[model samples]
Target: MRTRHVHPRPADPTSTSRRTMFVVLLLCVALGSVLAPGLEPANAIGRTSPAATLPSQDDGSSITWSVRPSPTDADPERPNFGYDIAPGVTVTDSIRVRNYSEETLRLDLYASDAITTSTGALDLLPAGEEPTGVGAWISLDSSELAIAPLEFVDVDFTLTVPADAEPGDHTGGIVTSHRTPGVDDGGDTVILDRRLGNRVHVRVDGPLRPALQISDAEVSYTGSFNPVGTGSMHVTYTVTNTGNVRLGAEQTVTTNGRLFFPGRTVTPEPMGELLPGNSLTFDVDVGEVWPIGRTTATIELTPIPTRDGDVFDADTPVESASVTAPTMPWTLLASLAVLVGVAVLWRRHRRRRERREAALVDAAVREALADTPNASDGSDGSDGSEQDGSEHDEPQHENGDRDRAPDGTGAGVGGAHRSGERRGPPAPRGNEQ
Candidate 1:
């Protein structure tokens, strides 16, 4: 058997850049929910479901055909076609298309350029779109095939590199597809095209530059209500492969609060591979970050060489980007303020209560004195007896005076002197001059 190679599409840089921007926007909107308490990273927003599988029949039957890279002598189990050719050189490859249905099938074979989807997965351009890169370089031996049931056909193709082809990676795919008549939900007739393919990676030998860049970095914090509690620091950024060589990377997110107090350091799983000129958006949440007024987050991407399509050397310097945002502990401050207010209110209440109690005690004492008749009269028991004796003595004197004659020193004068003696010298007058 002759050696055969199957090619897969490579990443399209322009499309990848656009998709990266879109991903950044999406991540920004979903960031709050991602950092919400008690949520898992897997449940983060912006995640998309898997692409729907193309139907193989009008009646919604299972796929009855398949296409993939075929085995070859150079590398029998090679997954896809990979090549390192110099300028003005040509290569050969093959793809196997199998028909597993009960009847024979007709298929159309073609090549298309590769592009990165918005979800960061690889996909091919739609049919009828002209490819300008590896897809245009590849030419298949036959464009149509008729295979019997349970049989497969090996289609050959030629990949010719132009004499002036740029010395880097070029990617495309070898695919087989079929068209079927279908009706849309709007009762309109449509053509349903389903395709399957293998990828091709071609590299022209030349000087390789492997570089990575970090862009649009953003940092935000979500704090807890507890004064001493820890919060989450979210870091988001876009990573772009700006060099000509395919590579991988080691991603790390480091955070620091005021005075360089380390919050959290996150070293996520390393990136396995990244196509040249492609971009990827990353979202990382570092937990247990204490809000210390402000926090700075740094995203560092270290290039890692990939050995899938061609020999790679990622000796470039590490790329880093940073962002800063205020992380004030508002909830904690509010709690402290409430406590202070409560203390002040309690102090005022206590002082008012003490003053009220003092006034009440003073009034009670006044009431007790009023209830006693001699409390402020300044007279004792001896004074009351003296007054009673004086009244009796006065009556006796009057009787004696009446019995005495009307002489110059009669009884009346004697009675007046006796009464004056009993009264104790007329009791010094209160108004005496």
Candidate 2:
């Protein structure tokens, strides 16, 4: 057997291990690139996330950055850019971005529309969503910029109001952001965007009709069984901004009825701000009220021009709404039921007493009738002694025959028999024949 000298094949280094190491190194580099940008202070981005004033400062280990509106901006102390503009007009403004950091910094500029959050606070539009309001009208001079350390740049922008813009307040913002490439430990790449913005408030001037309407008026009552106890009354109404200007309302709710004479007043929660065509519903609770019968609840609203600080005319009519609801008198109803029951029982007792008295009278009358003498019986109107004397005086006959007494009266048969028996010895001979 020619066993060829089997030269031991040097164990080839497993390619799997080398490949694993290479993948890990690549992942580490990518992760570092992704996370390195976040190492900076969050304040590097200004405080304009939600209606922040300008001159916002950010301090780093060896750097400071700031973003703000130019000094020439109106109402610099406020967080927003306020302007009274007319349709078909164009306005110009500027923003300043300063890099005090030791290293160069890059920034991206953008404009976005303002939107009201679910909690009623205002905020900038989300990324990737195109703006349709004032943001659509703004044009930035440059979208990208790079600044050397300790340097600053002013970016100019223009706002052109369309002729058909709605006559109301339009809000938007100018934003600056720094984006960096980042890779996570899982090897996923992402762009980290750190952004900040300054608010812009523009009012399109036109026919500013300030009007409010009250609608959907409702009244509810919670009753108590205690006649004198207090109950609860709730009144709800909706306040709609029916005009072109924003407004706040001073609301008063009044209830008048038997439960509350004169009237009961309730103050609802303050309606902070209402934009055009917006509506807010209010619920007013009035406790410790004695409600009875019908109650009329009225809501009155006094409009206050707050958005533009305009003076509301004193002659403006108050917006009012009313609703009526019937209240049940449980206590009164229970008392009436008790009274009715008592009346029915009393009536029944009276009837029973009358029936008993009538029955007794009938029994007494029957007894009297039974004891009365019969007038048809033949009897002389004389005492019993007279009748006996007449009968005894009548003569008796020897043959036991009695003569006819006057007035066609004769002794009863029994009396004749008794007289015959007492005359002994058959008429005693001398009285015969």
Candidate 3:
């Protein structure tokens, strides 16, 4: 067996070496691909991650990049532009640019020019571009940037919103340029082609803010201070949202030279929010003023947003309503009028009693005078008395002496019946008529 195998082994040819060489060549190619500096990862489908992980363009050999934003279209649910600010507010945000390439690349950050490629977003038909005097152009930023390959770089910015600024929509962008440094002048070297990207939409915003301002500095009420120097009144304040976006607000109400409602320390401080073009209302209480007089007052208003939202505000003074204090004159006058009426009535009652007593005295005097007239009729000359007698009395005749004698004892005793007569007092007679 050994002898037969030895003859076969001698015939070993170069074919085996040829096959080994081919296998070694294949292995070298595979290893070269794995170690290549320019090799890149495969691309993914769709926008599934926060920022698409892509290669950076250095010399434009095989680097890749994309222009991305949080949203590709204007979201009706969330508008692209707006601001929400309250008095004393500051807004802050962060921007991230992620590199997914195998090599380092330079990135230039700037304010994006308002533009899209001709085939990108040029609107037409019903969705055509609006007639804006402003055209879409590139914007430049003074910020600096350099990102390491496969690294995430973060940038931050802040917007200081004024308390008195009107709430509304504001739009802006952040652009990035991928190109070689010191090589941008007309392509001096074999530099990468100009690769530009942008965040087309950015908004400086706050929450829906609502504010309330009283036309009056303070409201009137049955406030503290028992027996207030002046009367009190209450105030109701209504706030209107005049901004294009919602606003979140907080507020405080106070009074100067006046007391708060209920008690000085009991003034209410309200906090809330309001939608855009909406209004809010509140009430305030103020104590009375001095002099029991009427007056007007103005209120100072300061409103601010709690979050990023739109709002409108004027730090100037705003007038509310006419204020009036209680007066003592009318009340005192009413009491005085009542007292005067009582006095007049008492005086009239006293005069009526006096007139009644005078009438009674006059009636008594007339009776006494009538009795004296009878006495005068009896005492006066007979003729005067008889003529002045009442109409009911009979007239005296010439036989008066005979009638008188008939009552006497001697002459006509037989003819005359016993009858008695009494003499009366004389009546008043005219003097030597």
TM-score of each: 0.66, 0.57, 0.29
lDDT of each: 0.67, 0.66, 0.39
Cα RMSD, each candidate: 13.8, 17.3, 25.9
Model 1 C-alpha lDDT per residue in residues 1-433, reported as the tens digit of each score: 2322233234334423545445433443343233333221211111111111223433433335666676677677666777889988998877777665545678778887766554556667766678888889999988988877556788888999989988777777776766555443445444555566677888888887888888888888899978878888888888888888767888888887556455678998786466677888888999988788988888888887766444444456899888998888888899989999999999999999999999999999999987878744645544544432243333233223333334654443224344434433221223323
In TM-score terms, candidate 1 sits at 0.66
> On residues 44-69, what C-alpha lDDT tens digit does candidate 3 reach at each position?
11212233222222222233333343
Give the candidate number with the greatest lDDT. 1
lDDT of 2 by residue, 127-184 (tens): 5678988789999998887767556787888999999998977777887776556555
Misplaced by over 4 Å in model 2 are 1-70, 73-76, 94-130, 140-156, 172-198, 258-260, 342-390, 394-433
In model 2, pairs of residues that clash are 34-182, 34-183
